[model samples]
Target: INEDSYGVDDEEEFHELDMTGRVIANNYRIESKLGAGSFGQVYLCEHVRTHEQWAMKIESHAMNNNPQLSIE
Candidate 1:
């Protein structure tokens, strides 16, 4: 059976901590969780000024512990 990945790339995966309702870099505010994976998690954030929504990926410490990890 042939499976389609919808152009998804595992090498481009992201990981991050959940920062719900928290502001970062004095620019954007984390809102909610979008998804997660073995490496990290993704969150939904918004711009403080324009209120534009964005998807952010955060790599976890465990992922960084491994030298083979993709995220630096």
Candidate 2:
């Protein structure tokens, strides 16, 4: 699910890098933030249906925000 949406890697696996409490795919609810970095951050999330917990990694997508890169 966490591939690359709008240059943001919202979800991956065992490393949900989004670092947010926002729900993804209408399933996982981001519980809290574990850590952060230039690439992304890890998040604690819970499954809405089964009441499961997991760590999700999300990419920061800092590359797209570069000052030099721009679309004409």
Candidate 3:
């Protein structure tokens, strides 16, 4: 897997905060950015307590109108 971690620099930190708002479900913390596209961005996240990791995708609603897909 790509090991290029993020949030260590200013630009990445800004993206991290903007995309994830720090953490989700009060359990996962974003570790790095994986990829991005017109839809939005994907991230590498870790469980705060268990340290387990997973990939997360955050889609920008403003980037798409009358979407064909949704996470739910």
The C-alpha TM-scores of every prediction are 0.62, 0.57, 0.59
> Which tens-of-lDDT digit does each residue in 1-72 have in candidate 3?
212333334434434444443677688788878887655578889999999999987654443453553432
How many residue pairs collide in each prediction?
4, 9, 0
Q: List the candidate numbers ranked by TM-score, top first.
A: 1, 3, 2
| lDDT score, candidate 3 | 0.62
Q: Residues 1-72, candidate 2, lDDT per residue (tens digit)?
A: 454563433334324434365788899998989886555566789999998999876554554465543531
- lDDT scores in order: 0.64, 0.64, 0.62
Candidate 2: count of backbone clashes, pairs at least 3 residues apart or interchain: 9
Q: In model 1, where do residues sit more than 4 Å from their true spots? A: 1-18, 65-72
The predicted structure with the larger TM-score, 2 or 3, is: 3
Error of 1 at 32 (Å): 0.8
Minimum summed lDDT over a 10-residue window in model 3 is located at: 1-10
